[model samples]
Target: MTRRTRRTRPSPTALPGRTVPVAGSIAAQSPHHCRTSPFSSRLSYDSESMRCRKGRTPRTLILPLAPTGPMIRRMPPLLTIHFLPTTVESARLAGTVAVMIDVLRASTTVTHALAAGCDSIRPCRDVVEARQLAARPPACPDNLGPLLAGERGGTRIDGFDLGNSPSHFTTTAVGGRTIIFTTTNGTSALEHCRPADMVLVAAFCNIRAVADTLVQRNQPVHLVCAGTDGEITAEDCLCAGAIGLELQDHGGFDTHSHDATRIAISRYQQLAHDSDQLLAELRDSHGGRNLQKLGFDDDIAFACRHDTIDLVPAFDTHSSTIRTLS
Candidate 1:
């Protein structure tokens, strides 16, 4: 039988020419009659009691509490794949690392040449340019004159020391010699990507090295495939896809899922399980078939091998040279 005293709500009080606040409510003022607080945008102070310009009274606006907790940060995608070298726009290549893939021969040959202890490889546009560069007088007595190396129609050019096949660049043959190299597809692809911030050569042989380099640099990447002739070759796309897959497996890159990249990745996934399957797919590719027809079946097998070489070759646009990435 305990009796409790009833609580009453406070009544609204008014000051002269002012609207007083009531329980749980603030006085509302017209925007014209209020001054914005300097400390916060959500706060405002009453000025004088005045009607709005439209002759309407002021209405109250409940300022919501400021949001809390950790802010969400979005990371930009770190990888972009271009199925063909020609697809790379100069504008997009401006500030990104470019990875050029020519697994059928040029990229693989260059990787092997570097691995064989060659000083550097200069990628020239054609056989004539390559020969001219090689015959140029050496700047220093200690410098070995360039070795002319190139292929035409998948055959070793007449009078050139080596073909585009990786086997030709053995340690005893190319060690410490500068190579003036040219090829039908790979060198042109390298030249096309010269405008990029940095250009790195990649092939199945050096895939892991290139992927690790890309992850270490942690920059946006443009994967450019050196297609055969004017058409996209399955080998090039497959190599691009393999590089993308390696990036994904390393777990830091936000890979773009554009149609070309997606197609490459899809093609790679279908053949990634079996070594023989991957090689078979490469041999069936347009470039692969061409190489095989030219009696470069060994080159196709060599190019299809994964992670055999651990060197990352970088193309220097200034000198038009490809050297091992330091």
Candidate 2:
């Protein structure tokens, strides 16, 4: 029988200052503390100490695993507004961000108004409210202290302060004034989405900027197309789809395409071979058809340009007005 000798193991507590011998080293059994390593003096590793030497991982570092996607510090909440095929009803706007899109004129007009430094816009559904508000002195506390503006059948309503035209919303006329606005299609759409957290009036005139604004805000946005008199209009849908595409690209927004929306997006993507082509399409659209008939063909052409302005007006519910969002 062969006699076997027992090997003594090093005592963990016997090691001073939590130091232990590394296997297969001349200094393994030595008590002297050698800070330098054979590999690199600057990269010494004390196995027993469970720490790296000088100029390695810092002690103060608190690194966590990297996140996979974009790290949004403050993501905005979701917003949606139902697009009704018929004329807008006040009930549809309950508790939603109403995006009133009248690509032909109203939305374009409002965009012009804001760009011209109009203080705010109060959208009214009832012409009576607009008339009453307009009749009252601009100093009346009950009113928005706005200039009443609207149109009926593409003509300015009789006895209103101003007409619905992008050109009409100049600094000379609208600067620093609240506009109490109503329109055949635009204000009706605005009234429909009054329930929304933010009501935005958009058009091709400010499409790209509006899209960027929506993404920066990081909210679920809905584009409401103010089609002509209870009928879907191609121009409004095209503008809305342009907005939807921009939102999807920038903010990863998902838009469930309805027939109207889908058609608009498809048509614009196909017909609008380029920016100039897009302008031509806008001029040829149903709303544009009427505009051309009304001899405002130039206005349609001008309003079709993308990213014209960086202004994004957000609806203020308390004041019942639209103000430029910072």
Best by lDDT: 1
Give all candidate RMSDs, comma-separated.
Answer: 27.5, 25.5
Instruction: Tell me the tens digit of each residue's lDDT in model 2 across 1-326.
Output: 11122122112232221222223221232222224212233334444432223342211212234477754444333434234435345555555455778877888888767766677788888789887766673553334466889788877888887887676776667777888888888877776676766777787656755765665445556677778877777778777767765544343444444454555555656644454455666676777888788776656755654434445667776777777765
Tens-place lDDT digits, model 1, residues 95-159: 88999998888998898788677888888898777767776734523376778888888899999
lDDT of 2 at 73: 48
Ten contiguous residues with the weakest lDDT in model 1: 8-17
What's model 1's lDDT at 67? Answer: 68
Candidate 2 clashing pairs?
A: 93-195, 95-195, 96-195, 96-196, 96-197, 97-196
True-vs-predicted CA distance for residue 249, candidate 2, Å? 2.1
